[model samples]
Target chain A: MGFGGRCFRVQWGPSALRRFRRSGCRTVRLSTVRDSTPGQRRVPRPVDDGDVPSVVALSEGRRHNGRVANQSGGVTHMTLTAVGVDRPGIVAALAAVLEDLGCNLEDSTMSILRGHFAVLLIVAVPDTIGAETVEAALAPAAHRLDLTVAVRPLGELPSLTSNDQTGRSRTVGGAGADLGEGEVYVFSVHGADRPGIVERATRSLLEAGGNILDLSTRLVGPPDAPVYVLHLTVGFPPGSDAAGAADTVRATLGEVGVQVHAEPVEIDVL
Target chain B: MPVRPVLTLPAPVLTCRARPVGSIDDEARALAVDLIDTMKVSPGCVGLAAPQIGVGLRAFVVDVTGHRKAQSCHGTFVLFDPVVDSASDLQPAREGCMSVPDLTGDVRRASQVVVSGIDPQGVRRTLHVDAFEARAVLHEIDHLDGLVFLDRVAGPHAVFPRKVYR
Candidate 1:
């Protein structure tokens, strides 16, 4: 009777087979309506006035859609990336061309990689010149240098200012709290390839509520006698009455058979 | 008027040989104050030579105490007609100038130095310094010798495009 009751949920009666075959015989189109709201959508307004608002707004929207725009000023942010054999006056020639376009050089990082000079620039100009004009202006320099030039309109500029004005505090990388006024200790430990050394020291410091600011570990020594070195700068809570925090860490690490050097860093800058 | 503007690059004054101070008088003291004021506003400046401020005198003001590398350092200094008594082996460091607003270069300098000079009151003094302090002193002294940071750069690779330092 129990087995019969369990089999009742399967609907293995003749009606179940007939319903499945009938459903397969019919055509059904499963379509979905995406919610594309008006306010959420943006329309591209090219630089007519060449003001920052229009240029930034348009370029920024483009960036969110996975595009890079260099438009700044009223004009679009101009960008040129070139890689050519290193020579004198390459930068000079490029700078002069940008200056002629009435373009304001915002930021540029140029370096010689191997035997070639690679340049990346963020330039701005008044909106009076359109994308075509900018392309034409840089063409001569690109030709003279025998370099490739790629131009594009920039999307809006992202807000770079810290957003911690509200009550919520912001931390870099969003994992730990920001550094507070307290004693900072820099600890270095080296031991033969072993387990439980890092774990033991970290657990000891964590129990004492010490915050690690920056930690770096590297492996040295021969493969047969591998050495692991851990260097860490840690922060302690303010007025925690822990004068020998570094020593305490060193002692815990010593039991793990690692040589440790713990010194109080001058925390005046923090 | 207020302190005179410091001469920037291509101004010609920055390359002129600085005249040695015969004595520290009111004029010299006023020039020192001008140098201090000029250094304070020269963006990422830590020192100013008289030649840079357009006075072309062998005097300079250094307050590297405010710099990140010079955070732990002796207080400010006002040296008139400074001369190095001795110097250690050369150590090269990257340096930027207010005159050369958008240029930086690696310049060779003494790792440690002892400088003899006069204060604003004409009182003679000597200082023994090491590391970045010595580098700052050497940079300002180069102005006295009619040398700029560009002149000390070994090659184009030693120079850098300047960026605004926070």
Candidate 2:
């Protein structure tokens, strides 16, 4: 099927934006809120606290790490990923170093992946700072905490969470106006565990003209008959066929013996 | 009545239990009016609690009239120190908040409820609410208790980020 639509295309193709790991990658919700940014509303979640798809435990004292963005006018985004053996004071030490470096923790996710403490941070670094300075600044903390770290700068950080007058939604992957601003929906799929499910399902959704916001897959049940569950948040630009996209996804995943449920994530204002 | 600014998350006032509005006095009446005014200004907002407008009092206004999801419409009414006399028929519903503006969560609330509270006219009224009306009542009451929809989510993925926060 031709992947042609009115949606804007990313420079690095669809796969370049988001990675869907096959075989064994369970999405975990790492809710480590260190400091609450005043007047800013976070993407509120029902925390199973230290448990999610794969249900990994959170490190200690990681308060306000993920949804802690108070910086208003920074256009640069530097994504930092750190992985190392799990231990106490890891998150706290990282947060302190980031704070000390004058780099604002725009967004962060920390979780124990495969028994390792993994942290992915979207930092708002001032123009005066560079990648080397960040990596060097974090070296001390990384060493003390026995962590491996890397940082890369992405161009033009879009305003997330807060709705600008434009209401233009741009994810970290730089899929700006290319992905039309529209209502967000959550698509949950589950079935017997099998290889190529992630690849086929994600590729089919893209072909069906859907913009993926977030996706996480989990494998559960006994090894004899494993059950794979995938939670995907997707959006379609205005005037796109949402129902049709859902049907296409349903059919595509069904071929691989998966059941699908698509629901619009409408937030009723109370 | 003025359309007061609604506070978002991390605001200490939105998390603390509100003080009781013992009587429907002028101050209580004013709080009720502001709640109504604020709710009216925001399109798609069916309910507003006193704490949302920075008033730490147990008061709120709701008007689900003509709302598509509303089955039992309660034109428009304000309550002071509202109390849930009975709530039954638990159901899951997606809810967003003016205080917690950026995300919505699938929260389980009663589909039917009997709530008693004093109105703006200094008269006590017991409301029989169901469907969306009941959800709105419970949501407002949650605000008075310093709780938002985030506190009642069913699971981690139950919450979804809003593309736009009004």
Candidate 3:
């Protein structure tokens, strides 16, 4: 069916751009601030005295591990990792600290795993700022929230050029570029957990000239015989045989004892 | 009638329930013409509601004669005070709206529908539509009741950012 024509493509104007900005698309991902009533006072909760020791121990452990490295080159990229007991305001506090340090958050994923809130973020800072400076700046908030924070300097970003025999070019800094001029599809694979499933499936797709845009995997079921589920959003270059590439990916992944399915992510315009 | 600009979200007229066109007067017929004109000028626009063009009246135009998904082909037609006589076979499909640009959402709508309404020629007509034509009719009907696809999405995650089309 010609579903493409049914999807509405917005014609942008000045007013539309203003509405897009006011939509709060940026802050909606990680954190949302609630407006308080005019005269309402929010009382701060008292920090547990016993939590201080563990916070100090965790911070010391991170420092001793030597994970914080100094890069002498003009490195502007850094990865920040933080973990603490799940609570409100952790993201807000960390964001405040980063803002004070003049760091721009590029990409981040925050989630609660086994009752602990973890944040892993890629940030861009001035060339003069080192990983140690970020770690030092986060020390106060980390201690206040009983979080273990670490920062590691990243290597040079990959230039926007085709790196392999395939004509696909890698997006700079891996910030997940828009799938320009491509056919987007969702690839789903699920089966009993085993080693090399991701490698084998992705390798076959890559060979078929499919570029993985976003990927997420989960392991569930009993630990003895865990089931793995992998979902990937991939893009095939325009004019490429998307159906043939999907069949190849499915067949390749099927050989690894998994059920694979691929479908076009269709959008309808009104 | 000149083709009017299609209004987007947060436009109060789009959300307010459109008043019924009790009589097919010159103004109501003019609205029908404007709806069709606007839909024709907007490439790929299969349907348009009166409120989308700031009319705030119960009327819409739909055409799916050549669409690939269209099974029950209906040439361009305008309806005033459309009432869905019957609808069945609910199915979920992703749809975008000119009024809610930059996003698409999954909406469960009936695959088969029978509707009766007053045509611009001052005649009563009923249509039995299925597949894409039915979907288009239901979408335009929503505007008459002050509802959009955003209100019908399955959940928050059901909405997705749409790529801009040149």
Candidate 4:
């Protein structure tokens, strides 16, 4: 797969699935269950009038089990997701719970979309704390705040290695090895919004043997005619023709009705 | 005079507002010489401030003679108790500091400036500087005020990690 294809996988969730379906995009529900741990399992109960008390009872039981699992030393990493209506104190409450559970927040992205607030966090917990333990601990806050919470254990990070085809070392997510040896440039494309814009631009650079270091896209302007803006940091091999590659990308994007501009990102050390 | 060790972030001396040089005594003259010597020793360094050498004195040395970016080239000079008389034509440019290594930021500084200070000979002088020379002077003045390029970054994303220096 190309660098953009591998790194820019669209996040699919229940709401996202529904939106995709409405937009006439083909999407499938990969899994309904949030947590994927084997031994301790709790199926998501359908929301109904009589099931509320039972759900609370099950959560309390899980919390009791979590107390027994609290041991010292071994560390486990997991991804935590929390979504609810926009309100103050949600982050503080979630942070308080994590702190109490002896978990460290490593990396996280939080933002408010429409009227809903979403938070995704990568946290490290002590070995004694399982995915169930984290979910159970968050139950009270989730219930009180009317939020959906899920926790799933993460696998080990993939080791970085050199790509045989390009003869250049590439890290997961397209972080090029030692930018000092390579030339870095900022590439920007802005114009009318259209499908396949991202794919086309990224494919051109990839074909030219350029690696994307970072990228972000935004759709702005009037609701009737939104403008698409794509900004990316790309790196080229030491002796590669960076200007030629950029020219090809510009011409390719220009054919698709987007204006392109590229400039070398200067870094001065004093 | 000898080349002194340049201080980085978290060094208390770099953060505190430097004290003015009351007079250019033997000690002050030696500090000026050390600043110039240290700037010469550090690769690609065009300027050095007293606070960078752990001395909280209002003094600095700048020499951008052969640098490509430099336009109003000043061979080499040292100043004590420097004050920016007037600055105009603000422009945003990427800058890194010896006192704040490993990171660079886009900071907006005046492109043209008139600065007054006492030279190494204890004589007062006013310099009309622009382009890279103005930038170097402004950067050193920031050090005297306990500020780095990080403080003047255009936005959060303006700061970037510097991979290498050669």
| Best candidate according to DockQ | 2
lDDT of 2 by residue, A1-270 (tens): 133212111111112112211212223333322223332433322223332222222112212344233445433568899899876556556556665555556556666755678888887666677888889988998998789999999776554454433432211111122213566667999999988887877887788677887877888999999999999888776767877888888898888788989997655667
Candidate 3 structure quality by residue, lDDT tens digits, A1-270: 112111211111112212323332111223111111111222222222352322211111112132222223333878899988876566666765665565555446666655678778877666778899889999998999899999998887432222122212111111112324467788889999999889987887788788887677899999999999999878777777778887887787778779988998765555
Candidate order by decreasing TM-score: 2, 4, 3, 1
User: Model 1, which residues run further than 4 Å from truth?
Assistant: A1-77, A84-107, A112-117, A123-127, A137-146, A153-270, B1-17, B33-47, B51-54, B63-77, B94-107, B121-128, B143-166
Tens-place lDDT digits, model 3, residues B21-112? 98898988888888888788775678989988888889999998788788997799999999999999998878877776545678899999
lDDT of 1 by residue, B5-39 (tens): 65554455565677889888889898888887766
At residue B10, what lDDT does model 1 achieve? 43
TM-score of chain A of each: 0.36, 0.65, 0.54, 0.57
Cα deviation of A115 in candidate 4 (Å)?
5.9
DockQ of each: 0.04, 0.34, 0.14, 0.13
- Per residue, candidate 2 scores C-alpha lDDT tens digits across B1-166 of 4777777665668777899989678888777778888777676678888887889999989999987888988799998889999999999877767665455678999999999999999999999999999999999999899788877875445666555322
**What lDDT is reached at residue B131 by model 4?**
85
Q: Given candidate 4, what's the lDDT at residue A22?
A: 40
Q: What TM-score, to 2 decimals, does candidate 4 have?
A: 0.68
DockQ rank order? 2, 3, 4, 1
Q: What share of the true interface contacts does candidate 1 keep?
A: 0.00
For candidate 1, the TM-score of chain A alone versus the native chain A is: 0.36
Candidate 4 chain A lDDT trough over 10 residues, lowest sum: A1-10
